[model samples]
Target chain A: NAGVTQTPKFQVLKTGQSMTLQCAQDMNHEYMSWYRQDPGMGLRLIHYSVGAGITDQGEVPNGYNVSRLNKREFSLRLESAAPSQTSVYFCASSAGGTGVSYEQYFGPGTRLTVT
Target chain B: LAKTTQPISMDSYEGQEVNITCSHNNIATNDYITWYQQFPSQGPRFIIQGYKTKVTNEVASLFIPADRKSSTLSLPRVSLSDTAVYYCLVGPDYGGATNKLIFGTGTLLAVQP
Candidate 1:
């Protein structure tokens, strides 16, 4: 399996600019998540999807939106970029089922800089 | 989800065993303790996980006490490459869908020669 893959390894956007971060997983996982990590800090969830067509807000869901068009794809959209949103973003997926281990597979993070 | 507390930083010499402990006082009955390791600019990788007692894998070992309030991640025979931030997460094991995982500022382990 290719595990999880994220697009645009790095991006820089100006204030009020909008962009979408792409996340894809080939593990056929039922759960997918988007997280942001600030320098020297742990990750905070932005959004998540339990399955296709289902999305939910996470701890820090403000300034962001998400969509799960299919089981293998989840996208994070930023309506208006802000400097505070400049951080490394990560996409992760996990198989969800009874008696299954809850280990998340993470993709290479996307580094975003909002000027 | 339960909050986790761990050391901010730890130092160890090469070839020595390193133990990083995380405290979760409000862990629920269905919650499991998991550990993840991350190097610079890379994604975090699963190291080990355990509910109670001990869980041993090829890479590391996870030890939880009977109360399951705290867990320790033991890395044996550490090397320079083992230097990274270690995260301890506690969350319920939902049967079909997992709730969000809260990642606090993890313990940064610096390995020295």
Candidate 2:
């Protein structure tokens, strides 16, 4: 199972450009999440979805938007990229259910550079 | 949300045991402790998790004390392949506005040959 997959492994954008990082999971998970990791820092949550059509902001949600159209996909969009937005973005999913563990499987990550 | 604190880095030699500790003083009653390992250019993978006491898996062991304010991840017989960033996460077990995990600066374990 491609536990989790991300598209456009690498990308470069201008200061005002916009892009979307795609995330998908085949684990039939009900919870999907987006996170960003800056150099020398830990991953911070950007947005998350409880299930299809449900999304919510996370710790560092500025300049970012997320959509969870179905249980298998979640996308993170940068409306207007900034230098501060350049970082490694990761998407994760978890089998959310009562009596289930909180183990999250992550994608390979998308490296974004904003000039 | 529960916050975690861990060392920035640690050094170990081949065949040695490496223990990385994390502190989560504000962890709630429903919070569980989980650890993840990440290599370069890859995403973090789950190592092990524990609610209390000791939990051991094929890869690692997690030890949580009675107070539950801290937990330790023990990697036995480390090798170069095990050299990676170890993250300690603390969060609740269910879904809620604050159910998301809180990852702090992980411990960069460098295994020497």
Q: What TM value does model 2 have?
A: 0.93
Report how far off residue A89 is in candidate 2 (Å): 0.4
* DockQ list for all candidates: 0.52, 0.48
Fnat per candidate, as a fraction, reads 0.48, 0.41
Positional deviation of A67 in candidate 1, in angstroms? 1.7
DockQ of candidate 2 is 0.48
Model 2 agreement with the true structure over A1-115: per-residue lDDT tens digits: 8789999999999999999999999999988889999998888888888889988888899899888988899999999999999999999888863111477898999999999
Candidate 1 on A4-109: residue-level lDDT in tens? 9999899999999999999999999998989999999999888888899998877899999999999999999999999999999999998873112488899999
Give me the iRMSD of candidate 2, please. 3.6
Model 1 chain A lDDT-worst window of ten: A94-103
lDDT of 2: 0.88
